[model samples]
Target chain A: MTLYERLGGEPAFQAAVDDFYRRMLTDERVSRFFDNVDMDGQIAKQKAFLTYVTGGPAAYTGKDMRKAHEHLWSKGLGDEHVDVVIEHLGATLIDLGAKAEDVAEVAELAESVRKDVLGR
Target chain B: MNPDRTARPAEPSSAIHLKGRTIPLAAGESVLEGLERAGIEAPSGCRAGTCCKCMLQGEDPPAMSQRSLRPTLRAQGFFLACQAYPIGTLELSSGEAPEPIDTVIQSVEAVAPDVARILLRPEDSFAFRPGQYLDVLHPSGALRSYSIASLPSDQVLELHVRRIANGLVSSWIHEQNEGQRVQIRGPFGQCFHVADDEQKRLLLVGAGTGLAPLLGIARDALEQGHKGSIKLVHGGLQPDRLYMRPQLSELAETWPNLEVEHCVLREATEQEHEGPLDQVAIRLAGSLENTRAFLCGDAEIVRLLQRSLFLAGISSAEMFADPFSPASP
Candidate 1:
């Protein structure tokens, strides 16, 4: 089975996405980035993005990362903000009982888009 | 024709003097891009400045954007080619050439089931910094890079070779006998002990044989009389894989400021804990306010730690890393 299947597919992905945002929105270092964002809409878009990227049936129809995060840079988004998000994502995956190797794989996938997200 | 008269005016372009070659740079082009345009293959990774692979020393220092450079390096005018944009004429040095050295294997012993520690005696002129790596050329012409695990004071080269299944160079290294001759080219990489401030705490973390360079660095730091505390965290897949446990423990006993922690991924034994190496290291050493971290290990672990440590208040410039990727045979 693929890592997505072992992670319990849609249900697990949903749980992880929800928990990840919950932790990220409360992180003082990164919460400010989401002050003006619509939490509900952002969460939905994130769910689809994670689902597609992790090999689920869903396809992400949102904007590309560079376009999606272009405005955030003006708000002082930087490498530290990206690091905080990745930490929360890893914590969420481990909290949801994913295997160590599986968590590492997912983290790497998230890290691959860092440059585009940072618009570097 | 008049001696002062020129047939045509010189085109306006930024000039870069590198290794006796002058290359023209267009507007908004990075040094690396300009070099590549001139058919120069500069070592680089992630072009975003997260990786320091494209480092070069030069005069007329360009403004640095990345925080990966050490303060000492910045003062010395070392900059990353991928990030440095030259505004005027610049003089940069090319990457150093690797010198080939012939050495005789003094001993090869199994430190773990799949890990062998090979000691070599090189020619009298051979020298290398702790945490640097060397490329080993096998009899079959296959080459592999391994970090130098011995300090400069040792006057000998040491390598920790992980026996990859069916790997050409690794298998050859494991089967080699004492007094066997081998060809190596090296002493590359910049992730060594700098001794910038002897009072700054040292946090050295590695996984598996990644501990090789870290061991050398820790020893170098102590030899240099660094007054701050030094912590070495070595993690592996299992307890038995923490190969230098006895040696590191002995060093810790004699060095009052040095502490060694052994960790395992799962099934923690009484002596070792079950956790990731980065997390375990952070938990043991609270508050990295003034710490200089030297990281070498699995690429994924190194990346994870780089992000985590940067978020935990450690400046990116203070952390030096050598991420290891498996070489294909």
Candidate 2:
């Protein structure tokens, strides 16, 4: 089976994405970056991005990561913020019963975009 | 707009042209840092130039920091990007890098008492050069690199693994079952024959499983219609330890230009040479002029031969060595 199928596909990704945002929003260190953003649209874009990156069958039509996060630099997004998001994402994946290897894989994929997410 | 406005001097911006894109470099920044800043993902390991993973061809002469590169590679303008700083506008080329692939073991057998010859069938897209090495990710989460012993035409990857006592990865590899999936990451290193000329003589020396890559190199040279003589010396502590003697003898019979010799340290036989393999090879080879030499196996032997060959008038450009190291804990 494809990694997407093994990951439980759309339903699994949605639950993990929801939990990721929940944890991120409550974390004081990274919450300020999303203070003035539209949460619903942000969540939808993030979900599509994660789905596509994690081998799921979804097309992410939103702006590429660098462009999407360029405006966040002025809002104090940095390496620490990216680290927090990755930590939350990893935690959410584990909480959703993903295999440890799969969780590590997803975390590595997210970390690969550190420069883009920090607008470096 | 005032027509009399004096044009400001062009800002000094050093840059590198790589992959058809211009990446500006900051003062005191290495080429690798500039490429990373431009979002170009260059393959890197150890990032200090020791691993040679970030090697790239450039238009400029190699930087002083690139003195560790092979003389041939440096002469060809290949430099480690991690250590090189842009002098001016430079054009760098990094051809399509090979990606890691999943492979399944086809078979594994002990060709020698201590040596296991493993055959693997990689996914259809996986490809590698003959003398390159690959990193095997073991089920125990340890990674160990092994050289490829098979020719490209074989359609399967072959590895000669010397069983290391108490080694995590090597022991696991010896215990692995047929059809087990393995994650392989590379085809790395630059030790293959380039066939620069048809009459270029080759001297290959190997010890233990180091013979694996040398064997691949010899077969590749012969297959490519190399017209010059190919001499191979396999060294071991005992006569019975010269594992591939029969196969090599068969190969010698088929390829008239190829000569195979086995050298043992403590035993003497009319068919084999006595003493150290490197010493025996030097005696047999006579002069080192104009011959390409490849040395592999024990680190001490490789070092001794490397120094000996260099002093005997062999250019550093014509010598290639792969010093063997045991798998890390």
Give the winner by lDDT.
1
- Give per-candidate clash totals: 0, 0
How far out, in Å, is residue B274 in model 1?
Answer: 2.4
Ten consecutive residues with minimal summed lDDT in candidate 2 chain B?
B3-12
True contacts kept of each: 0.00, 0.00
Q: Give the TM-scores of the predictions, in the order they appear.
A: 0.61, 0.58
lDDT of 2 by residue, B27-118 (tens): 98888888888888887654644445677888874466466555546645788888887677778865665566889999988888888889
Error of 2 at A22 (Å): 68
Give the TM-score between model 1's chain B and the true chain B. 0.76
Interface DockQ of each model: 0.04, 0.01
Say what the RMSD of model 2 is: 22.1
Please state the error at residue B5 of candidate 1 in Å. 28
